[model samples]
Target: MKTAAILNKNQLSKDDITHLLMLQDEHEIELLYKKADEVRKKYCGDEVHLRGIIEFSNYCEQDCLYCGLRKSNNKLKRYRMSVDEILSSAKAIHDTGIRTIVLQSGEDIYFGSEEIRDIIKSIKTKFNTAVTLSLGERSFEDYKMWKDAGADRYLLKHETANVKLYSMYHQAQSLRDRIGHLLYLKKLGYQIGSGNLIGLPFQTIEDIAEDLLLCRELDVDMASISPFIPSPYTPYKHHQSPALTDTLKTIASARIVLKDAHIPATAALSALDEKGRERGLRVGANVVMPNFTPAPYKAYYEIYPNKYLTTEDPVKRTLRITAMIESLGRRISASQGDSLKQKVLA
Candidate 1:
């Protein structure tokens, strides 16, 4: 009743929000998840969007401390897929009934604006799938070019809204610049997707609340609220990942607040706990992005270890995910899983 009352009221005190964040008991956690799922059903419906992610490259220029693909990590082998290989992967994803393909890579400059443009253009021209890019920060011209090339969305995770922690991990970058990129992507007509990393060192409950608040303020099409898993090669590798319960609390709170935004039951959550993703789905997540990156590369694109989102074989993986979705009594989304916010504005 307290949860319902707090959510129902137009405004909640910081203390009320802090209470929401501190919910750790199984019964209260279930209540929070149930409420989030109900709100999700109200806004996003029962269809779970599956975005086939192809990790096309691992070459990065930035040395972000927590990521394995940082520029200074010479021990990690790097590879960038040719345009043909990427297109071939997209075609395979389309063939398997996936409506969207996310071309995610490290912040590598090997692929120039025209090169990335050509890849985006080819994917849009050849397949019926929507293209989403996660190529870190790029020039405004590059963003405009890709949008003109028919890229449907751009995902640039804010990572965390706390400026201090963000600066500590990102070195010279500021939260303002990160947000500026998201705003620029939005201005270029791409459905902008931004999210936060839960359970980072020095992250507080207030920080978690602010993350959701920022997502609402941005009116992002998608918000990825996943638990933080420290990479082996990163500086804070020995640091602990977020507790599963803490992750679920953050996910549920985001759902209740964002309501209509598409939140994925992230692979990181599943990596931490075998049923974590399923629990997320039961609560608030309406999307699952299975790795469609063909093998040898999929295992190599390790942002964190022990990620088992999908197998090398796309066909078998699709069947397995479909069965998993069916088990949860949710239908697989058949369309391009376009932003529900877009429809709301329309």
Candidate 2:
């Protein structure tokens, strides 16, 4: 199939998506990126939404093969920030003009749902900002509690849509169950986000195509297309990361397929290349999530090795990120960065 025709299509079939992902010709790939950029411009404007992430805890129960923070990794130094510390970091994020506060941690139920709910309430009351929870998968009751406590969004990356691979990587975690949690979160009125990792071992172009299709089917408010960077102390430590071009193509394709969804130039991209985030913005990504996890803890929240900005001061990093966004002819968003989709609860 011709690249032009594929790019011009209003609706993409699974086969069409597969073919686009398989495009190796330089000119055709460029066309795919151009179409994605055009679609991004039409659906999402030139404002790069910033979400300040605070990885408060590095403790995780499940031992996923790719993550460095897995429970089995004895070498990792785990720490959980106190509520006062978490609120302090959130204040730092707000002072820098970031409106979304993303409280991300591994699946550490030690904080209990009520503890998390209190933190959510404190942040909501202390600062007029959006609170996004990424504390792994939790119960539906816990989700309702957090929502009632003023949590505005939830990010639970489906990681991959292929059933066999999902089980293989997540230690038998069910993809159906993950999807169920995402659906239930949306049902509770929180703007939901989910995504897949590019270039996992044994993953094929067909699998990636299915991942993009899943994002569209879910009608996610945000979709993150990030590279699979191998971590230092994991089972797939030596596996090669995906090519930069492949990652870029996936992001561009995602924008074309899910036009109005907020796509982020993820921090993992920067670990792949210094200009990875900027490159992602040019293609189709409209959101940038900068980590504000305090130093001692930030360095330990290494889901992957050589995490971008793990050591930089949050204030300095925010300034640099602001300058970088401006360099791309984009401005930082002032709103709490609400969902682009029209509200229709399931």
Question: By TM-score, who's the top model here?
Answer: 2
Q: How many residue pairs clash per model?
A: 0, 0
Error of 1 at 90 (Å): 0.3
Local error of candidate 2 at 212, Å? 0.7
The model with the greatest lDDT is: 2
lDDT of each candidate versus the true structure: 0.86, 0.91
Residue 193 local lDDT, model 2: 96
Q: Which stretches of candidate 2 lie over 4 Å from their true place?
A: 307-310, 342-346
Residue-by-residue lDDT tens digits, candidate 1, 1-346: 6866776654445666667789867777777788788888888888999999999999988888888888877778778887878888899899989999999999888999999999988888889989999999999999999999999999999988888888998986789999999998998889999998888878899988888888988999999988889888789789999888888888888888887899999889888998887888988999999887887787778788865545548878778878989999999989999999734321
